[model samples]
Target: MTNEFSNSENLFPAYNQHEVVEKLETGFKKLNDKFINLLEENQRIKQHNKNLQEENQDILRINLELNEKNQEISRNNLESNKKYQEISRNNSNLIRINNDLKVKLQARDKQIEKLQNDLNLEKQKNKEIQRLEVISQNLEKNLKILEVDEIDINTINVFKENNEQTNCNINKNPTTALNYSKGLDDIRIVVGLDFGVTYSGFAYCHVIDENMHTNDNWPWGVTGQFRTNTVLRYDDEFNNVLYWGARALKNRKQNSEPVKLFNLYLGDLPDNLKPKLPIDYKKAITDYLREIGMFIKEKICHLDGFDYFEDVLLVLTIPAEYSEMDKVIMRQCVYNADLIKDRDSEKLQFTTESKATALNCTFMFVDCGKYTTNLTTRKLVRNDPLHIDKVTVQIRDFYGSRLINEEFIKFLRERLGTCTIDLLKENNYEGLQYMVKKFYRRITRSFTGDDKKFNYELDILYEAPILLRHVSEEIKEIMGEIIEIKYNDIKKMFDPIVDRIIRLIHIQLLNNKENCSTIFLTGDFCVSKYLQNRIKEEFSHQVNNISVPALPEVAVVRGAVIYGLSTILYGTEFDGLKLVISSRLLKFTYGIQYNWKSSDDLTHNGKNCKFKTLVKRDTEITPDQTFSFNFKPGSKQISESFAIYYTQKYNIWYCDEPGVKRLGILNIDLSDVQLDSRSINFGLTFGQYEIIASARNERNRQEHMATFCYPDDDF
Candidate 1:
């Protein structure tokens, strides 16, 4: 039984071992599956990690490339900086070079200055040699010849020029700042004129003394030169932009003065005798007029910059007897002067120069101008009428200035030679200038009682006293005759006429006829002493605008400026020029039975002839042409008439006469005359013609003749 039980246990144990083995196999199978899954997951993780590593490696390679490129770029930048440093160094060197160049230039300038000094010394030496050569050459020329008039004059002039040049050169060290060129600034000048038929007085006064100056002509930017005459001279070298009026008149003698007496020829100028340039009566007058315009422009420099001339007032004066044609010439001066500023010249008011003094000091004006005596009546209102008849206007044939001139001429003649007149005629006016200066002081002391010294040189004032005297006398004679004759004749023969004239004035002023509100009287002949009393008596009750300005001689000039402005700016009426026809004879059988001569036209014919006017005293002429009517000086056998006329287009008179026309007097007929042959015009006129009879010495029967410019017919 034990063997059997042990065998059973062994079997049981074998079975248990088999059961455990089977269980263990199941567990192993499960664990193996789990292990396989785990292995697969780990393999996937390993793959991801490998891929990440590859991507990282790629990024590292890219970064490495970028680093290499950056290093290369850095190297290139370093090279660029080195190059930049080189360029900057070059620039610095260039700046240094520029500064060195400036220093070199300064050194060169000093060297040049030294060279210039050396050259100047050499030039001086050369000039000395040249002067020595010139002296050697001129040894024969400068030989002392006999004192012939022209030779002596030339020697004196040469010596004077040499002395002046030497003086100028020596005095060039430090010249005083003169007014001639004051810091390149503009100048102001005031020129007062007192014009007359014979002698024209002038004064240059200053209003604003803005600066100090040494030149009298441009003293304080003002220049005044005057004498009792109209003479002119010029030298482009020294007096290129300079001008003088009275100074020129003073140098009329010794033939060295550049002046002439054209006063008489003013009314009778030759048709083709107009001078172009250099010097002549027309040019002299024109230049003086332009200077006057310049002076006016300078005076008003404050109004404008004076770069280009702006507004300028040019004053001119004329006598009461100035013909219409004369007025035309006077106006031309202004018009031509406009060319200076590339503008049209204009005239201002035309009043009597004498009235200026009266205006300054008195309520009335009584002046004795060269040609006539004039009186101005006033009541303060500008629109008042001036009674022409109430005033006693007088004229005479003599004047103080003219007498002085005559006396000076006599002195020169006695002191000088027979060729004195000829020398003066040869455009030599230095002598006259000297004489005028010397005589100017004397005359001023004698006439005006002013013994003040004039601004002039002694030698320059006494050279051509005779020539100056001639011109002076001429002016005085013409102007004096008018004043003296008017005074004498009005008191003697025209007392009844004066009464009639007064009554006419009474009618014109008292009635205030023809819509006339103002009566203004102006002229060189508006200040007669006799006329003053008459005007005071007649116009004492009437309204008048009597104007007397500061510059009496320039009254007419100022008036002309006003007229010009009115005409240019507005549509204003102006009286045209009036032509004057002096007395001329076409017939003269009334004086005497005289012998015939081939030389004289009146006596050329052998028979005792009776003459008549071919034109019958009616004629008209244009402004462009002159009317030349035939006439004869008073003689034993010739007859005469007075005739002349002026067209409306030539009207330039500034008178306010309603019925008083600008009439032209004509004595003879004008046949078909040639004037350029391109156009033809003709006309006729006659008024109040007169006929008279007279006899010469030792003749019984009164000669038969006619003398009148007006026709008897009222029609």
Candidate 2:
């Protein structure tokens, strides 16, 4: 306004200045209020962020806990599902068995009805006939009961004689046949059994006394004799056990027949031989072992110092040649005998005959016994001095003395003509067994490959009356008086056995790269002088020394005694182990089923072949080494788990080839686990004699019972 028009402008300018100052003060006050509000808001926001962060941490911890809980629930679910499937399978088997029995019962009922109709038609004619009919009806009812409790021999189709299959049926609620839980803590004595084909015995020792111990009075006549013949006899109908061991061979009855070479047939026999055996082979084994167990309980377990049944560790020695399935059957027999609880694997330990010999011998050993032969070597591993493991190397095991005995039996049968055959055909087998036992015990043990001959004179005094009535003049002339067997005839039997043993020795020498100088010979069959001489002569160049232990017959059982004692001493931590077998060679290829990486690799025999190998055949494994596999649930459903399937209808699906065996399914439950796409992990550790398996989820480890079911093995 140009200084407010001269003099007037001075007063206007002053007023304007005062007004501007007031406006500036107002603007400053408003700005200060806004700053104060922003500072308060900033402080409040910092406090809020701190509270949120704490809440987020709590939520994360809760999620972790929930995941852990979910994992545990999933494990439980898995276990429950496995149990359900097992129960279902068992129920199906029972149903099938029941149906078979019903069919048989219907057939019997029809037969009875026909008999009754005939009896009714002739009712007034004869009371004796009615009485006979009642007896027949009673017999029919008893036979029905027998069918329910007993296994039918004709139905058993034994797969492989070499690798016998065991019948494994899981019960809904399995209860221990014997009381094992009560006296377990009081165990002071351990026992070892050598269940052999030709002979059987046991050794025992106190937890304190480590030296070998044997029952001097082992069933038969003498005080020092520790072994008895492995034989069992059944009554007329083959439904009941009449006697066992030496008594069965010695005592001949009208209706009883001796079951010799039962151990060789522990697995099912060939199809052709199945019908010849009128009773279940597995049952026969169990029955025989039960009697043996009873003998042990009375003689050793019930001794003054040890009165309780469970206060003992019973170890068993099995043939090294036996397959895994065969071992399982033997274990089942032990369970059926009530010697130990069925599932108490820790209490019951099994050692191969060769392994036991290796444990006891200072050098390599050859165990030539009744049914099989085994070659073994022991080596020391000093890498871990504190827990030094004994590594046992088993070379070969195959059919041994029994094969030779069969050849001898065949020769005898040929020489004896129809004399023994006619008796067997007529169901009069007692005399034949008696004659064989007499000749075997007396002459067989004394045979040597020499010009000297043995005289086996048989007295047919009792059979003279029967022979006279049913004999042609030519046969009568040959069998008139005593039948004598000469030494040359016995030599024929020794030669084949000796030759076979020599071949085995040659193979043993070839396999042993170390040129082991010494060889130890032990077992009942090794007691034969002729066989021993032949082995020595054949291996003279390769082997520097071939020696048999003084107690060849009892060496295995005695070694078993040492094994048990060593387990007690060395198995503990505070007491250092003086002897131990740390590792062993793998006999077969071990692996698990798995999904294929691509569909192109899935086809086998026009079906899907899905599997991956974990352990290859002949691969060396250590106790510390672990094998693992993964199982991913494809579906979102919690109930779904890893399932095993077959590629072919009947062909076995194995990880490796040549001869593939069937595989069993693994039932792992994941029903309760929140699997937002997570995989289940499994691991395996090679134990002393078993492969230990474990399973785990994302959050925690899972517990499961591993059950392997094979179609060919079902009973």
Candidate 3:
């Protein structure tokens, strides 16, 4: 069967084999289709996965944008919070200020009430005085009715003397009779400021107390010292004041420079002689005055019933040689510093340093200041109010005590080489100042002319090692060693200044018309023992009474207070009881350039700029005296300007003269005056420190006043 089957199988096997091959091929084709399907599914799944990745990236970007927006919002909120906090702080400050103002107002109310009560009391006193006058009048009438024989002789004489005294008192006190009608009664306190070149001081006096009080408690000053250094230190740019007064001299800031001797700029100084200032001289002075004014206000405003504007009178002492323009500048500076209310404020008054010093006593005052020395001789005209008259012309010289300090500096420059001194000055200026202070304190103040008695040694090399490398070996050796300042070395410095002062005093005495009974040594330099001894030695024979008042350094300041008080009190009810400086000699001849008209002739002179004299130089003039000139303006003229000129010369014919300088122009407004009566009376009242020019229209009584200020070119 297997064979046959095999044969059949062979035939069948051939068909079967063909069938098996067909089946195999079909199976392989099925597997290939399955593989193709799987490949297509995998491709679709990969496309879906890529789409999911893109969606995730979009979500992540949206989240990042949201976070960035949130951060920006947070920053805006923080900035708003800061601005709100600043506003809140400002509100708090405003509330505090409001509270302070309320308290000040309440205090002012109390002061007003107190002043009202005083006014009432003064009125009652006036009524009582009137009653006493009536009773005295009745007694006089009864006495006149009685016969001489009936009345006792001694009683009659006593009654007559009493009547005469009452009459004299009534005649002298006209303002008192008027019951305080004048504004002089408003003065409560007077403060005097002596702003010296090297030192400054202030003195205050109450009108009621009439007792002088000086401020010795200056910042960084000795306990008993009345004056402080007039030095100021400014920042590098000079826009701000870093330090002032004694503190300025002690500051060691490397970038700051000290400004002193600025007071000299207020005088008629040559351009070369003026000090080099980083800032404007006026600004420097104004800053200094502002500080001092604040100190004064603080000191005086604390007193009961004291009003700075209404009750206080500030008397500022100036150099005698200061021109009217200089005085005006000082006044303007004072106004700018808030010391006075305005430019024309009467609260601020000026007096010469010499005049102020002379008010202390009738003597030859030798005020030896730092930069200038002034010699003035005054005669005691009346002792009741302590009236003094200037006898000799005031003399001012540059040979002051600072020259001694300069000589001492020169001595140091010689002892230590110039290079070493310059190096020290450049590198360590404070150290140099310290050395000078030490020299002044240890040697200069106590040194007498006698070398045998004085033995002092100054250590100039103690701070020199730091600068040794920059200097030469010779300078190094000199700086490394201490130098001995013997009495001769000091005497050499003192003799030049002291001898010049002595010569000035001698010349002053010779020129003085009145006998210089007493020679007063005043000012900061007057504190020097050597200066005092030398002055005494030189002038003891000429002046029998040579004296230095207690606290002589503050003499000018203290006398300034007296002067302010006396000026206000003089010619009033308090005339005989208070010190009064009644008269002063004019320093320059004041005149106006105008066309002189003759009363006899109707023709006008061709001379248009003729110099008409008003007040001559060296003429003794009282403060109340006025020289008046009548002027008739043209009918069409609306204003008339008078050109006032001044000169040291006795006589000048023309305004264009060499020595004649234009003081100022006084303009009189004639618009209000009647056309028929255009005559104006122009008057000039020369005071101790200023000239007041006034123009009055006779028809309308319209007056205009101005103070004489020299032209800018004169300065």
Candidate 4:
């Protein structure tokens, strides 16, 4: 049983094993199926999740789109509100503007009404003025011309002067004026008359130029100019014209008879003298000017610019001693040329002969017309002339016009026989002077005492004085007998003028300072040695003088040239030249220092020993001049170059003082020069010299240079 049981157990065990195996397999299969199902469920769940996510995304997108639409609607509402607000504001502004405009319109209308009323009032006033003008015209129609003539006009001439300010408004250029076709085209001319107390000299200048308006084909200015001095004598109811100028000097025998109109007696009337009508002295002057004006218009205005000079500039020379009243008349007569500003012409500049001679401007001039005796001076230099810069103190009585007359008288008296001067000693003193002057004019040839020429023998000179004495005796026989008269009256007549001049000089020396100052003489009178001696003898230690020789006569004119040069070359270095004292021609030079004129007054770095100076004070000098001198090491010349000083008009003028009428100064400053280099060059001018000279050694220098000078033309 055990075996069979064991077998059955074995089989059972097998079956059991098999059954177990099957169960095991089945369990495994069940586990596998569950895992597969679980995986499939998980996949399905994932699919569901994906679907839900997609659906949520769609809902979120739709919600966002709805939000965007709402925002757009809100934005539209805001925009509408803003538009309405803007429209309201604009309406308010427009209303305010309209109110303001309404007010302005009302104000403007009122102003317009007022203006119209004022304009009407002005129109009414103008009408009233016109009515008054018409009444004035009616009243004038019955008035007479007063039979006015030159005599009456000249008598009241002082009141008629136009001293009003000269018109200065100017334009760049103007159109040409209308051509004149009036009367005869011939130009006329008249010479001026200068009546001196002792002698009457007439100077004639061309009143008109024959070819003034003629085509500028030829450059010959004028064929020639004529000048003469008329000295006539009576000859049995006839008057004979004596020689004029050189001719008068050469012919002496034929002019010895006395006549009536001899001397220049302004207030007296001569028995034999007659004019077309009764005239006073002043009347004659005007008549002469009038005649001259007419002549100028006729003969000079034919040319374009030729007449411009004559009509605008009427230059006349009067004695410096002319009364103030006479000056007024002369000024008026000059304007009588109708020399107002030309509507179509440039303004004319008035000037003197001295100014013309300088040639500072390109202006035509008439010179060599009338001449007066030239003054000469030696400039008496004393140690001190008071204390102040008594610049113009005439230190001495000089050889003047009176002296020339005296010399002439003395010469004639010594040669009375051959010159026939005794025939002039008539009862009337004026008549005597007249007759003598007439004869003396042509007496240049009366030196006919068989004068010996070319005596080279020195011994002959000793005998010459004896020969001269014999000649004098012979001359006395040829002339008529002379009757001497009291000379006291003649002396008395001239004493007052001489004394007055002396008084003026006396006053000049009374500066009253006990300082070392010099009287710098700057006029024509400084050239005379007699004047120098006079000042030394009279004023002595009170006055010192500085003279410029020939320059003083025309210093002002040369200064005018300097001024013109400066005017044209303003701001350029071409205006002036400077110099340093190279070598010593003199030591311890004496100079009169001017107060507050140079670097001392205006410059920052100033000195006490130096001052500025210029050369054109008509101090005598030469053309193309060069020189040298020494100043003490500390002494001063001109620190800031005073070579040329400029001016606005005719900066300076030269005047002649034939008698005792010389005085004045020249102006100079530093604006006229510029430094050309670090080293300076100087043109040294000293004393009154025809030529300036310098040398390294005055001891070795044998020859002194000389230069000849002519008179200056004042413009």
Candidate 5:
């Protein structure tokens, strides 16, 4: 108030100042009240804002949860789609499997139809055979009646005796007649398989004209290949067959290796060479045979209008030296190839290599003996009539190609290191083998009559440039290096093989007791002039005559075809033909395992009670003969086992003689017989190529089995 209204109003100014002060205080209080109200309002707004923030946070949380649920739902839909796709694929697979099963069912139906047709044909053939038998009986009777008028009383008596003996023999072997009835009359073709170690050949013949046929041609290198290489190739790891035969040779020429000598290691491998083999040899043989089967079907057995399988008879030739076990393995190889799946069928036949070769030689003797001065002028031949009978034949293993091939292989390895040879084999095995073979053939063919210069060129050995000539020492290097070989060096290789052959021939002659004036040489080795000359030179003093037929290498295969026809025509209307081998000489002494019935039996009194000889070696035998024996057990036993033993040696001196080998086991169950009261009857027959044994109990029930124990066999 102007400093209190300037005192004026000194006293009055004091009251005015006090009133102004009160108004000032009142104005300050109002502003303070407004400030307090604003504070309260701000507090209330802050509270509201805090509540709104909490609510907003809750809403945000709920929204996040909803988003997460949506994502989970999408993931579940994806999983459902994947399940549906998997189910669809499985359905497709099931449909394919159903279609495959349907195809198999149709094939089975066709097979059943074929079997039924064959059964009907077999029935018809049986009836025809019965009718022919009756007609044959009538003709025989009429011939006897007509002979009585044409001959004297003594001849008539002889005819009666001969007829009675023939009747008795026919009654003894009923199965001989059964075989005639069982044979197929619709046979149009016969096949022969000569599955040899070094070579293989196949032949076929028509029964109508009886002319043999052969597959003289083959593929992949040369023409007129009657025999292809027995070779096979596998994968790098040796798991599966890649190729076989000539095709194998082609592949081997192009950086692939092959397996050879599989034939010699069919069932048992030689100890010296076994460790070198890395794969199963039997499987290799099976694969090789499978290819051969295909070859035969495609090349030789493809007749124009007939099913080759239905009208064909297959005959396989086996080495005479092969044991029963080896024969079984050969049969298995044939079966595994699906060539002759049923061994029990009459369509399949097995003949010995020696037997067939002998028959063929005899056929030549009958055909060509009249034309050769060597046969007609010899004293031994003059004493012996030109009849095919009464002459003994000797078979030996010296007449084989194995020794020569082995020596050639040895020569290759010595000139070339095994590592280098192995590498070359991996690179071009066939080229190397073909080169060696050409040299071998050249040497064998050209080196005759003591010639010193046997020339061979090594330029064809490989694709790389190289020169091979006479060298002083052996050296092995790459393909481009010079390879030196000499005539004397080559002669050294052939010398040992020649010596072995001569030694074997000498042994064979020493073992033979029969007067064999005529000697027959056959097999692929017959193609070797050196072998032939050596044989003729060495045996000139002992043998009076020698003969080598034309196409001597094909003799075994051709003879097999002849044998098939002979069996079919035997004892039939065609039996009168001269093309028949009526008898065979046993090469081994056969016997039965015998325990002496009485201790006092003088024949075996001081000897080991083991064997009784039934047929001696060198004795002539008919294929339809049976030998009977009595079995009397001392004790009461219901079952027993017996064995058959054979000896190539002189005799079975003891039960356990080193030379005596157990041939087979025969089992007999005598439960139905009076074991303690009666003796059992047993019989053995060699009517076919294999042995057949039969046992009869007291109840008259008979059991028969073809028993042959195949032992480990080696060449």
Candidate 6:
């Protein structure tokens, strides 16, 4: 208290002082405790402040990362928007292209419809022309008959003046009629006419000389050429002939188109296979034959001691696949051409091209023509006169060198547009022909499948400049003034045809029972070095020899002359000097429909309309073989008719089978036979060229000979 009241007393003051010191110590201790507590609390507050600062730093970093992610998402959205816009533009372009295509397709459809209409109109016009042609033919035939009668009178008069013995002989044998001329029985000259689809030629042989002569002197006067183009041209009305052969091919007029490949119509082909013709095919054939016949006649007349009416024998080479009706039509055409006086004249004989080619050699005959490839296998029977027998059925295919040209045309249509080609054909036919001719002459004949050595360029614009106007921009960009024909391009065209020919040869060899050691190639296409090499390479192991005869292009025509000589001089002094076809393998089974209820028949199963086979398929039949059959005449029947049918089947009971075909009808006169006669004997003789039917009465011994009647029989 006042420290004790200033000294209230010294003794009391000393005690107060000690008490004050203790109080001061107690206060100081309390203050020190408070200071330590305050210090500890200040340390905790500093730690808390440091933790808060770290949390604020983490929050700031997380916000910055989130902002970067938002910016990346914005960039992706902008890219997606750009892609969608680009797709929309592409869709617009596609729609425009589709519309343009639709327009072009409509235009093409319209063009096709117009072409169809034109074709129908052309068909109608063709029908009218055919009718007119028939009428014209009949009139021409009547004129020919009158001319023949006049010629017959003149011939008789000449015979009476030249040789009285000939007249006496003719009078003694009334059956000889006006044909009893001095040289009528002797064939001094034989002419072989090879009427091919692409080429035509004639070869003449003198019987005494035994040497063949081919007519190489054509209108163009080209040497070493025995064949001419089978091309013809008519006037604007198609009623008169304008040009023929090479001349027709050279002449390019706007009035009329050239007619080619008419020889294909001579076969009995399906309607789909037949081509459209500007004129009647028969007339076309007749006209062509007439032109050739005139040349032949003029040439023959120039020969010494040659008479066309008596000494000339024309042997026409026909396709092996021709039917009897086709043969008949050909014969009629030949007669109409004035090659022979009568349609049934023996002066004109028909033989297959394959058979004629086979007769020319002992090995297999392969004729690779422009339109067809014919194969025939023959075995050597006698080598002295070169007699050969048919070993296998003939094979004919439409694969030929012409197909190569077709493929080339397709190539052109592809390279340049089809419309461009069509326009060229329509505007400049000659130019189109020139282009094809150039390709055929330069490229097709020279390509050897060697790619490195092959470098050829065809001048397209020079030949057909008009095509430039019609070609598309794309075509122009690809092909300019010239078109390059590579080795692969040509090889692709040749391989298909070559493969087919090889396959045909292989099948023929496999079917042949005899070992085919040698192969003989003939015809124009055989001249191809590529074809020869391929055949050699393909059959090197199997075949021993492959020989291409000299002048193989004329082999068929020359062989035809030899065949004519052989057949006409058979069993004579000149027979040994010529090649003979001894036997032929029948392609079909020939039979006559007859009742099987015969009295002497033991194996009759009571079958009606049975097929009595006379010659079976694949059976080798000789020229002189005759099949005999006997049938009793009905009591009241004065005449009988037999139906002849042919089939490729072996076991056949009826005539109406799927493969059976009615060949012809045979008529027999039984009026001379008595009703009481047991049976009337009938005989059928099959010749290489014709068939003869004979009927004889068993009691009266009266014989009547007849021939099978064809469809369009004029004789």
For candidate 3, which ten residues in a row score worst on lDDT? 571-580
Q: What Cα-based lDDT does every candidate model obtain? A: 0.39, 0.60, 0.73, 0.33, 0.59, 0.72
Instruction: Name the lDDT of candidate 5.
Output: 0.59
Instruction: Order the numbered candidates by TM-score, best leading.
Output: 3, 6, 2, 5, 1, 4
Taking the tens digit of each residue's C-alpha lDDT, what string does model 2 give over 1-715?
Answer: 5655776766558759789788899999899999999999998999999999999999999999999999999999999999999999999999999999999997897688557555543542343343334445555644555565545553232222111211111111122122232323345778888888778888887776565678768565646667887778888877777788877875565544577666767432334332245676677788888988898878765556675345677878876546655766677678778887644444566776765665566444677766556556544333232222333334333445666556656765675565644654344355555555555556546766654755657665443345455656765666666767667777776676566556545544543335667888887678787777777877788778889888787777777766665565544321221233355545444455555656465666555554555555456766535677776765554422233322222333544445555343333445434537666676555654434444455432322223222223220
User: Which 10 residues in a row give candidate 2 its minimum summed lDDT?
Assistant: 162-171
Q: Single out the weakest 10-residue window by summed lDDT for candidate 4.
A: 164-173
Predicted candidate 6 versus true structure: per-residue lDDT over 530-630, tens digit per residue: 78888999887998999887878887788789888876665222212222358877677777888655565534355466778877778877875888888
Q: List the residue pairs that clash in candidate 2.
A: 4-9, 78-669, 389-582, 390-582, 453-487, 454-487
| Model 1 agreement with the true structure over 43-95: per-residue lDDT tens digits | 99999999999999999999999999999999999999999999999999999
Candidate 5 clashes between residue pairs 3 or more apart in a chain or in different chains: 7-10, 325-710
Superior by lDDT: candidate 2 or candidate 4:
2
Runs in model 4 deviating more than 4 A are 1-279, 283-325, 335-400, 403-504, 511-529, 532-545, 549-715
- How far is 84's C-alpha from truth in model 5 (Å)? 38
lDDT score, candidate 6, position 151: 63
For model 3, the superposed segments whose C-alpha errors exceed 4 Å read 1-184, 220-224, 252-255, 303-305, 451-453, 461-482, 568-715
What TM-score does structure 4 among the candidates reach? 0.27
Score candidate 1 by TM-score against the native: 0.33
Runs in model 5 lying further than 4 Å from the true structure: 1-178, 235-240, 253-257, 265-285, 322-333, 363-422, 460-486, 571-715
Q: Pull out the clashing pairs in model 3.
A: 9-13, 385-579
